[model samples]
Target: MIPLSRNSAVFGLNIDPIGHHNGAWRHPLTQVSRAYDISYSLELSRMADAAGLDMVFIADGLSVNRYAPDSVVLGFEPLTLLSAVAVNTRNVGLVCTVSSTFTEPYNLARMMSSLDRISHGRAAWNVVTTANPNAALNFGPETLPDHDSRYERAAEFLDVATALWTGWQADAVVADKDRGMYFDPDRVAVTGHHGQFFTVEGPLNAPRSPQGKPVIVQAGASATGRDFAARYADIVYMVSQDLEDAKAYYQDIKRRARDHGRAESDILVIMSVRVLVEQHDNAAQERAAELAELVSAEATLKRVSSFIGVDLTRYALDDVLPPLPEADDIQGYRTQLALVRRLVQSGQVRTLRELATRLNGGQGVLSFTGDGRSVCDNLQLWFEEKAADGFMILPQQTQRDAENFVKFSLPVIRSKPFGRQRPEGATFRSRLFG
Candidate 1:
């Protein structure tokens, strides 16, 4: 019932309808038929809200074929679904993914600003420059622009959109019911801007929301991506499995924030983690084994190949991976690319099949699998060592398993000194930054 103490680790959920595992739907308890309905999503968010997590994040992509893992498919557009969820949930933050690559700055700005207002300030945008090569065809381009080029465009896009968000001063609106004047013209002014990617004439049509604007969340692991996030992102999502790697990343981002004239605490670093929990450690391992049995070696290899931009069909699953591309040259999801390189070179996975199955859990972010107390213990270690300021919860193989997280893990967290049961601040930004 009480707020988490100052040093408690923050947490949020990235809800997966069926689940994040490729064979999640095969789980007997998951209501596969309910995965597509708006009611089901509302149920998911309500579960998080009731359990007292800080936010429920909905991830999106422009191309359906991009990352086409069979078991987990996002059912609705992030913005539209969040709009519906906004009116229903009272406490948890509503965060959605929006591509800075294909969208116009003006339109994206308007929608996000409107969502923030509609949600009464508990809104966040997971800004992305989509990496799918297939996504280019949908936008009339034959190919995705080179990685660096896309980041360049994204920098300009963010500048234009943010300017529009601040065009109206906080006190610009003065509704005088007796006189019937809706706003004061002098308080709002034109943005009057020109830029490389876009040119917007004036201020946005919508007024600022209760939180001033939507909190900026980003997930980019490349060198360029890191710099971009350092300059603007309020929260940075990472897919780091190893502790040393995670700490290095945390330090670099904090340093970059200082370079950008931001306080070290200005940027929040969130590590994505997979959770499989139960009443006892044995029950958790049995649950893990059950999910492992359903995994198909071939399907997983194909998925892994798509992520690293390599063709692995020629090699048998038992063979060692052929040399992989250096992390710097990887064109898609650099986070996954880094994981692949780590798994192979470290001899953690001696064969292709081991690597494929390893990546099956939310692209191989670290897994916290055991009883609730043990899971929280490990999470506290990550938090104390400066590996992460917080964590993004990736639900395991079923909707029931997802609920299992709230039911089992949260109570333990509430009892632990370093664990938090509820979101910290009144608004999404305040919760993250303050």
Candidate 2:
């Protein structure tokens, strides 16, 4: 297990160009034209790095989401985009999503190792077994594997990738001119990995990176997903609706890690939060209301339908969601589907319209809209209560909202006992698990 500083919290920014809210692109302050441009992301990375944030995470999918227009799609491939951001920033970690189901283990190892070298050892991989069934079509498959099956493949994929990453020992390179030796060839070993999903005979072409191996991140909340994460992930990005849920998830994952003979502290659990920060509470509330007003019910329904693998449009806006299929049968995000199901069964969420609106921001992540102080207070409470190790900030409006949080809330957060400031010359692994 990686050792972490006691009482210190880790922070990351989830950079979705269009913003986390469904209506953010339509907001008056948002520059829709720059959503696809690399400069925009570059600027955001600079801002985040300046704030001493730990990392900048880019979410990806194999195909554009069906509910939204192509304009709102993730404009850059995650690795290619983060590689660009890596040279521009000095301290912040660059994490990008890559699907294990569609990608070859050897190729992923090489790409991540290359990025780690390029960034001087600040690369992280968010491992995902693509949840979007549409992703299957892109990869020439008629259907996505079942929930357990995908996790099974992901587990094997990680095993092979890790083996490839460890192909060359830390001291493999000799670089001796007098002896005419570039490397100690005996120190490098081939990874003869043969598994149910992959066959990789690799002594990765790329040498060992500065960090030895880039950090591994996973985002899965179902039973199988949690087991997979406990066994392999260095960090877990999660979605929790409230404090209780967050606490439960935090304890469950940690305990599971222990069961796997791993230290709980080795895996950092960061929850996703959509922040709407303004100078005044009233303004923040007003901005949230305005954004909500802009949400497209039709677009939202289609989006939710795609997420749960159900045609939600068939039900009336006022109707509560009916019972869902078992997770074993669902091809989409079964954990998320179970979460929404609980909300419906508990009467906390009543109608389809309400669910659509709630999910519009951060896709069911906890949302906090208030002045900077209030935002700080909320984060502190979560950290203190053991509900989360930290949060992945997803701004409601990319420019104004994100900038406001960094300019205002970040200072307050850093001033607190649990808050952290990045150390000089800190590598991503050190900053994450200090």
- Number of the predicted model whose lDDT against the real structure is largest: 2
Task: Give the Å error, residue 115, model 1.
Answer: 1.0
Candidate 2 TM-score versus the reference: 0.95
lDDT of 2 by residue, 174-232 (tens): 99999999988899988987779888888998789988888988977788888899889
Per-candidate TM-score against the hidden true structure: 0.95, 0.95
lDDT for model 1, on a 0 to 1 scale?
A: 0.82
Each prediction's RMSD over C-alphas, in Å, is: 2.0, 2.4
lDDT of 2 at 46: 85
Steric clashes per prediction:
0, 2
- Please, what is the whole-model Cα lDDT of each candidate in the order they appear? 0.82, 0.84
